[model samples]
Target: MTSVQTEVVEDPKGLLNEDDHMRDMERLRMEIVAIRQPFDSVMRVTGRIEPVDPVTWTLPNVAVRIEVESPAGQRPVSRVYTIRRYDSALGEVEIDFVLHDDDSPAMRWLHAVQPGDDVWMTGPRPHFVPDHASGKQAAIFADETAIPAVFAILEAWPADATGTVWIEAGSLAAVDELPEVEGVEVHILQRAKDEAAGTTGRLFAAARSAVADVSGWTVWAAGERQEMRDLRNHFRAAGMARDDLKVLGYWKKGTSSSELDRMRLAEYARMRESGLSMDDMRDADIAV
Candidate 1:
C-alpha cells in the first residue's frame, strides 16, 4: 500500500557526463523499485510531484503490478506497458497504458488517474531479453500492447542494426507514428472487432512478402498464445532454426493470469509430472 512519489535521482556527475556527447547510445536501463514499506491504506492523491532523475526504468517485456478497485472488488492486474518517456528533468516516469471499455480494474484506473493521481508499482523482474548475438539483425511482431516494448528494444539497438517491425492495431488511425530507423520497415495491420481473439490473419498474409528473407535474423514476437503459435509455425516453415526465434504471450484471450495458475495445476495433475523447461521445447518438440 505504499504511496508512490516521484523517484529521487542520485549520482549527478554520471548523469551530466554522458549527455555531453549523445549519439543514441544511452539505453533505457532498469532498476528494481521494490515495495519498501507496506501501505496501511490506499493512496489519496495530494497533488502532483514530478520526478527528476537520470536513467530511470524502461525495458521490453517488463511488467508492473497495479492494484485498483473495480466492480468486482480490489484486484491487482499485471499489465504490459511501454515507457513513453522518462524525463529526468521533469521527474516523471511516463507510461503508455492501453485503455478499454470494460470492468478491467487496470483500464479503469488508467482512465481515472489524473495529473495528481498517484499509484505504487512493484517490478523490474527478469522478463525478456533480446538475442542480439544470434544474428546481426532482427524482426519484431507485436500488437498494440506490445508496441511500446518493441520500441524500447529498438532504442537500444546499434546504429548498424537493421530489421523489420510488424505492428497490428484495431485500425490505421490507432497508429500514431513509428520512430525513424535505417533498414527498419514498419508495417501496420488493422483488426476488426468481430474477429476472434488470438487470430493471426494480416501478419501471416504479409509473411511471404515482408518476412520472407528474415530467416537469417532473429524473430521476436509477443501477443496472444494462438498468434504466437502461428508465428512459431510461420517461422519454422520459413526455415528459421528453433534457436533463432523468441515468442511469448503477453496474455491469452478469455484467460486470466490467476486462473492460469489453476490451469497449470490441472495440467500437471493430468500429466502426472512436471519436468520441462522452455529450452527443452525445440522444433517438433514444442508442447502448449
Candidate 2:
C-alpha cells in the first residue's frame, strides 16, 4: 500500500496541489478525532473526514502521509502509512502505526496527540493489489511493522483464494491479536531473546523447514531490509519464479524512513537500469 507523493505541495492557505504530471494530488481535509491502540506498540488513528463527493478511491489500505513531530520540535514531519479503514458512510478513515522505537518520528508525534487533534493525510494512492488469480496460493511474510499491510491485503483477497502468512515479531505480546479470516493460514513466530532481528536464524529456518510445500505460492514479504531479501531469495531458490515474488524493505533496522526511501530509490534506479522491476526479477513459467 505504498504510494509516492513526491510532487505534492501545500500552499500558504493549507491547500494541496501537485505538478501537472501528478493529476491526482488534490487535497481533502480531515481531522484526528479518535485513536486506538489495540497493541502496546501499534497505534490506529481515525480521521473524521468530509465527503470527497466523487473521490471514492480513497478507501482502506491506501498509502497516506501522517503528520508527525521532529525531535527538536523545530519542524513537522510526515510518515507514510496504510489506511487501516476508510469508512465513506461514516466519513472517517483510520491509519495504523507500529512503533519500532520510542523516539521514532511517527511514534513520538502519536504519543503526544489527543482526541480532536489535527493530522493531515495525503495520498499518491495505493499501488499494491493482491494477485489472487496469479496462483493457487500466495505467501505473505511480515513483521509487526507490516501487519497493517498484510491484513489489509488479506482482507482484499478473493474469498476462494487460499494462502499462508508468517508474522515474526520480537515478542508474542507485541503482536497479540490478529483478525481471523478464511482461506489463509496464519503463523505467528516469536523471536527468542537472543535472536537478532531479520530472517537469519529461527524465523528463516522455520519458514524454510516448516513450509516444505512452496510450489504455487506468489510471495509478498515486507519487513527488516535484509530479511525481506533473504526470504525472497529462499523462495526463488526453491523453484519460485521472480515475477511472482514481491519484497519490500519497510525499514532498515537502524535507518530513518526518509533515509531508507532514498536508498530504496537509488536501488530502484540501478535495478531498472538492469531491467528489474523490483517486484519482477524472473518470470520463467511464473505469474506476474
Candidate 3:
C-alpha cells in the first residue's frame, strides 16, 4: 500500500483530558507533514503502437492521464515532450523519442517497449505556449532523434500559425520519411546522404536566409552539439539576438553523458569568469 498526502481537517476531540489534546496535536502535525510532501505518480500505458512514420507516434491523453502512477511516492520525474499527434477518435497520442547511438534510460525504454506491453510515463504538464497573435513565428530545427520534439511543436501550433522547420537526416530515404505539415515549410537536409547531400551546409544556408529577414522569427535548434553552436554563431553574425534564439546541444558527437555534462559545466564556468558572448564560444572552438 502507498501513503499519499491529503488535506488536514481540524476536528474537535470530545475527550476531556490534556493527554488527548496532545495526541490530537501530534496527529495534526503528522497530517500537515504528509500534505507538504509532493505527489509522485507514474502510468502504465498498454497497447501503444510503434511509430510507422519513424518521426512521430500517436498516444491519447486519456491513457497518459490515467497511466500516471507513483513508483517511489516521490514527485514524478516527467519530461517535456513534443506531442506528434493526439487522436480523439482512436484515443491515442504520439510522442517522438530521441534514440541515440548508445543506450540510455529513455532510449532503452523506447527500444524495449512492445506493442501489447505497457510503458510507464508520468506527466503531460504544459509548459510554454507560443504567441500566435503577435505575428511572431516559431522556428524549429531538429536532427533525427529530436524530430519528435519538432513534430510536437508543429502539431500543437494554431491552425493559422505559419513557420519554418529544418530537419537533418542520414539519407534521402530518411528525408522521404518526414511527415507533412500544412503551414510549415519543411526542409530536409541530408547530412550524410551520400557525398552529395551535405545537411549541415544546407542548414547553415537556410538559416542564413531566415536571419536576413527578421520580421517574424524566433529560432530554435537542437541536435549535434557542435552544429547547434555553429548555427548559433551564424545567426548571431546575421544580427539575431541571443534572446531570440533558443539553441541546445541535445547531444554531442562521440561524447559520453558524463563528459558532455562536464564540458557544459566547464563552458558555463568560463562564460561566468570571462563574460564571453555566443560569438566568443564560436571563435574559441567551444562547440555548443
Candidate 4:
C-alpha cells in the first residue's frame, strides 16, 4: 500500500552527488529489440541502448533498475535485474526474468513488454565478481534469480582459476544454458514443480555439505534473503573472513520488492540524518 503512494523524497543535502553517483546513475533509454522464452521458467529480453560506452556498459554482473507499474497500477515502481550478456559493439544487452506465479510489478512489465517498447532505467551498476585473483577456489551458490549473473560471470571467467557453482532451480533447461568453463564444475539442485522457489533449502544444504573447510575457498552466493543470510552466517562461523565471503539477498521469501525498496529508502534517510554515507548502509544489515 505504501508503495503506491506518490511522495517525492528530495535530497536537500546533496548526499547522492558525492562519489560516482553522477556517472553511475545516468538514465538511459532502452528500446526492446526482442523477447523470447528460452526456458519455461525464464523470459529473456534483449534491448538496445544508444551511444553505449564499451568501457562502462561492458562489465560482468552489472544490473539495471527498470521502471514498472505498481501492483495497484497507481505509481511507477522499479525492479533490479542482472544483465545476462552485453554486446557493446551492437549496443545490445540481454536480461533474463525468472518467471514466477506472483502478479508483481516485474511480471506485469514482462507480460506487457513488446519489441518496439521503450523503457527508462538507471544503471549498469557493477556487482561482486569472484576473487579468482586471490588464488583461492571460488564457491558459488545461486538460485534461478541469480542464474543470469552467473552466466555473465562465467563468460568472463579466467581459464587459470578453479571454482564450483551450485544452482538451485525448478527447471533443468535454465541450468543447462550456463557456459562450460574449463576449471569450474556446475552442479544443479533441481526443485520439484510444486515446490516454491525460496522455500527449498537445497542450496544452503548443498553448500554446507560440499564446503567443509572455508580456508581454501572464497564464497559468492545470492538468492532468497533468509537463505543467503544463513549462508553468510554459516561461512563466517566457519572462520571465513568478511572480505572472502560475498553473499547477497536478491529477494525475500514472502515480501514484495516494492516494500523492500520502501524500507531501504527509509533506512537510507535515517542514515543520512545521522551524518552517515551510503557506504555505511549495507543491504545485508537491513531488517526485512
lDDT of each residue in 20-117, candidate 4, tens digit only = 24445566889999999987999999999873455666779988888765335333468889988888778899999999988667887899999999
lDDT of 1: 0.51
If scored against the real structure, what TM-score would every candidate get? 0.64, 0.74, 0.52, 0.91
Candidate 2: the clashing residue pairs are: none
Q: Write the per-residue lDDT of candidate 1 for residues 34-94, one digit (tens) a residue.
A: 2111121111222112322234344444443433432233233333344543444444444
For model 2, where is the 10-residue window of minimal lDDT?
1-10
Candidate 2, residues 1-288, lDDT tens digits: the string is 122232122223221232321235435566778888766556778878774442544542466666564334222356777766666677777677775543666766788888887765556366455567785587777887777777667666677888788888776764455567798888888876666566444446656886567776677777776666666678878887766776766666655675554444455455556766545422221211
| Candidate 4 ranges with C-alpha deviation above 4 Å | 1-23, 70-75
Candidate closest to the true structure, highest lDDT: 4
Clashing pairs in 4: none
Top TM-score model = 4
Give the range of the ten consecutive residues with the poorest summed lDDT in model 1: 34-43
Task: Give the per-residue lDDT of model 3 (tens digit) for 117-193.
Answer: 45444233232333456567867766764565565565556788877887776644433445566777877766652
Give the poorly placed runs of model 2, Cα more than 4 Å off: 1-26, 51-60, 70-76, 170-177, 192-203, 211-213, 264-288
TM-score of 3: 0.52
